[model samples]
Target: MKKFNIFLMLIFIFTTVFTACEDKIIDTTEDKIQTSIKVTHINIPYVYNVTNESDITIEGKGFEQTDSITFIPRGGQGGGTIKLGIKTIEDEKVALENSPYFRDGEYEIRIQRGILDQLLGRTFVNRIFNASIPDREGMTVKGTVHSNGQGVANVIVSDGIEFAVTDQNGVYYLPSAKKHGFVFITVPANYEVSVINTIPQFFKRLAGLASATEIKDFELFPVNNENHVVAFMTDMHLANRNNDLTQFQSFIEDVKNVYEEYKGQNKKFYGITLGDQTWDQYWYSNNFKLENYVDQIKSLEFPIYNVIGNHDYNPYVSANDWLGAAEYRKVLGPTYYSINIGRVHYIILDNMQWLNDGGSQGVVGERNYRDFLDQEQLTWLAKDLSYITDKSTPIVIATHVPLFTNPDQNGNFNNAMENTSELLAAVSEFTNVKVATGHTHINYRNSPAGSNVYEQNIAAVSATWWWTGATSAANHISRDGSPGGYAIWEMTGRNQQWYYKSIGFDKDYQFRSYDLNNIHITSATYTPSATDEFKGKVAGYAGEFATANKNNQVLINVWGYQDNWKVTVKENGNTLPVTRVRKKDPLHIISYEMQRLNANAEPTSSFVTVNSAHLFLATASNATSTLEITVEDEFGNKYTETMVRPKAFTYSMR
Candidate 1:
């Protein structure tokens, strides 16, 4: 009976063990549930100067093979596929369209599986995804003071609205503005704003547009009781042994001659070398000394105020061991300091990086041995300007760069100061203000035309276009290779005038002055071809519009890279009548009609629409005869081009 019981117990134990094992396996399989991964949105950070992708690690797990990944933008737009495995995790680039430039919102990434083919072992699944690519905003307004192109710590700065002193390296920060606005320094008494007159205008608006924004980069003209004729020049880029420097002496001679001529007639004159007065050849070498440069500048008879340029700072000369101010101090004075000439206040600014070309010029003054402006100077500027009781006293602001467009349309003037908008608001409260600057070789004059102030950009007195030869065939020379010029600004009682006169080494100096009273583009005319396929070239009277034949279309190429191409035929700003063409068709000999305002018949650029004219031309291979083209400018400048249609016979008709 016991043997029977034992057999029964063994059978029972075996059955229980088998049942328990089966239950455990079922529970483990149930715990492994499908996750159904879906990518909702991908956030890509904003990048301006940087070329690489800001945020690369894409979120959303459970990426299945053969799944379709579609990118859907927020606004009404088409979708695109996301090519995976093509780019490694390390190498990813955010395309321009997907960047903060145009699209700045969430995007849906839809993923679907089993749509094209059947899954091997898993069940069919569909997943929807979305991700946000936020728009990159502009940086806040910050100020960094620099001395000797190096930061001098603890400089105070006030934008008249917000005030902050720079830290150890002469850096300060304030809130940013919504749009591109003007700003000036409440400069301390001992220190001056880089450009005191017009002030540095910061442009935060129109970012990432088809064209880069145009902000004034230099200082404005001086406005005081003195009817002074100041000669302004900068970015000479003079090396100790270069031909451009040789030509610069000639410019000085010309200025001296002009001043002497005026002086002989009992006229008053003054001069200011904006910055970069001398190219420090000793930047990396100890062979040359600061006294060598100072001696050369002292050669000029008149008292020339020198604004500190980047080249003034020498790397070989240690800033900490040497004088507090760089070697330039002996010749140019304090880097962030200012000078008062008669009723006008002059502020010399340092805007280069604190470190060398290889390093980044930090917002704070201390990081780089390079470009910066400190707090002490900014404090002095505010205190000094505050003392001026007469708000009408015209302020003449000067700097290496204008607050707007520098040499090319790409440069900005308010680079060093963070509180540029606040400073501009302060200056805007004043009645009269003007900003003038150099560094850019090109000349730009802005008056109440587009904005609310007057600004002037002076041309370089040194090498123009880096003395790049006209063509590759021409060897690259220095000043002899390009045009070198200086400016003579006349500050009168009622209005201010700027004369950008190019004084070549030996050529006769000429003066070109502009005023708001007579700002217009005159006549713009083009000739058409006779053949069915318009085959001809069009010429114009002005420099802006030229003649060209493209795809049997006579195109009067209007609009320069800097400004639009518009023309008028008379002295008074008026447009002539124009003939209409096809609806929105590429223009062909078109016209823009304008009513005459005055009887002055003298031809000026304000009387006709140069852009309104257009002409069609035949294709190059389909031409049969000679096409004549003519264009005229308001200044009576005429250009002509002929397009010879291809003839069937090789020989001439004659």
Candidate 2:
């Protein structure tokens, strides 16, 4: 039940637009200066869509006092208010002249008040352009993208397969076959398109035959973001279950605080979500779907360019991959697109092909998808890269799954994305290419030996599926012990830097040190009051720390560790040997594992504490010896921890 409030005086800003009485244009105006326009279905509460342009019939009251009608385009397109005089006038109904029809897009209609000062319906119309497309030679779609009294040049435009760029006059034409039935732009640097409900309107749907021609245009506002800060958010997995809403609110607040802190630094802020905004399993059961996901983050001040994860497909549309992604494409623009922020050329891809094996009209499927780029995406990537002449431009390929998998205990890497070779070869020319991804629910950076591409497989915002901190409000740690948070990327011209920001903690909180002396998770102490089903379910040392040896050892979990990062430990003012080791995070074991065990429930294996390669081990001289730990990333930023011997480890320890 969301409403778009429209006032008659809005013409000075948005509009007192269009005479068409369509959609639920609820009159929420405060002044009551004039009545609003509404097209109420006589038999039922229904609003008609803009189906035809020739026969524009508006049936509503207060039409006698209506002077003119206007149509305000959504998402801040270049064209101003499209006002039209009423052809027929009456107290109950009226119709505009059979001309000046709206193109294929969303628009808000408003009533121009007459001298009598009567109220009218301020309606919102989704104009459906089903006209006969004209045939053209050499170009199928053509238009000019202009803004602020002039045309902007060198902007990239595409229809998924074919790519083109605007000329010096800001005019471009695509010789497209209309394969995807939509055209979009790669919103160039220093400019941005407007948005509706947090979704960027960088694309427009097409009409008619493949051989037909259609003209589509996009206008944007110029911005100064050469030195910008983008919030790399990912893996929301919002399903209205396990208190996810509460946790998501906390995430929003955390982002807002971060933005406010950096608001006055002469830098613009933007957000990019790595995907999994909603769970398809709960779309029908909880009555919360893609639209609900948009409403959740509507309070944010900036527009969020999104990526599509495997869980964001239509579960019951297994008839085909295209059908499965229909809802996502309809709700959140295109599945795969690109945009420019500063010197960074970002390409957002949809690698998860929804092969929902056993789905149907009303039945759920296996909900399984793969981590591979399809042929079409690869082709589009090639077409997009062809337009960029500067090979040194920092390219960021954002997908849901990592292109390269994280290394294991023996420093061995496995192929996660099936199309890694193709993807690598595609971007091999770029000198500073990087990939940002999620879905592992753990933080890890993958840098192949001599490859130009680097990957940061970030963790989830809803850490551990919002389970660890549901009731206790403690330790919202990921599988690798990274706290529930997002990545902060600072871009200055061609140079880029990033760091993992733990929510509820400062930016300097990079690593956590655990004193083995005070760390032990035993069923006797944690699940002592549990029932028989889960009495001895918990284990000490979490499988790795199962032994009873009282070795004076310290384990440090550096969630943001990479190959070039350095770790050092000093005990009693003397340097101690530090070795990289794979082990489970103890705090995660107590915060998530023991919590479920104490509740007499078998903990999910996926959510359980697992061995992480980012861990380091150091042996101390004595149990009472104080140790100082320092970690330095490749960017030369250092974080330190001073361990006052037998440092207490608790579920809520920071």
**Model 2 — which ten-residue stretch has the worst lDDT?**
39-48
Cα lDDT tens digits, model 2, 1-654, are: 123334434643443244322222444343363444333431211222354445455776545434676666553222456676778866656776543445345445666654332223343333333233344587888766767756678888899888888888777789988767678999988888877666777887765356655667677899987899988898898999988998789899999998887787878888889989998988898877877898899788887899988888999987477878877776786889999987899999988877888988788898888777999999989989888899999999899988867688556676698988999999988899989999888998887878898899999998898898794636688988899999999999988888999988999999999888676666776777678767655654267554444689888999999888999999767888998988788788777877887887778887887778999988998899988899999899999988888787777776
Computed on alpha carbons, the lDDT of every model, listed in order, comes to 0.40, 0.78
Per-candidate TM-scores read 0.41, 0.83
Candidate 1 matches the true fold with a TM-score of 0.41
- Which tens-of-lDDT digit does each residue in 1-654 have in candidate 1? 999999999999999998998899888875453244433344432222221243223333344444544444432111233322212222222222222222211244444554332211211111101112122234344434544444445443433334455567555554434121222333332233331111221111112222222121111132333555667866666655434445556666777676676567543455676666655543334344444544445455444556666555654333341232345643343444444454565555655444533321221122234333344445645665665677777677776655554222222233323544444555665677776676655445444434445566665676332232222112222121113566676555434554544554221222111111112223322222222222211222222223232332222221111122122221122322322111111111121111111111222332222221122112222224344433343234343344344312111110
**Regions more than 4 Å wrong, model 1:** 1-225, 281-290, 317-325, 357-373, 406-419, 446-453, 465-482, 493-495, 505-654
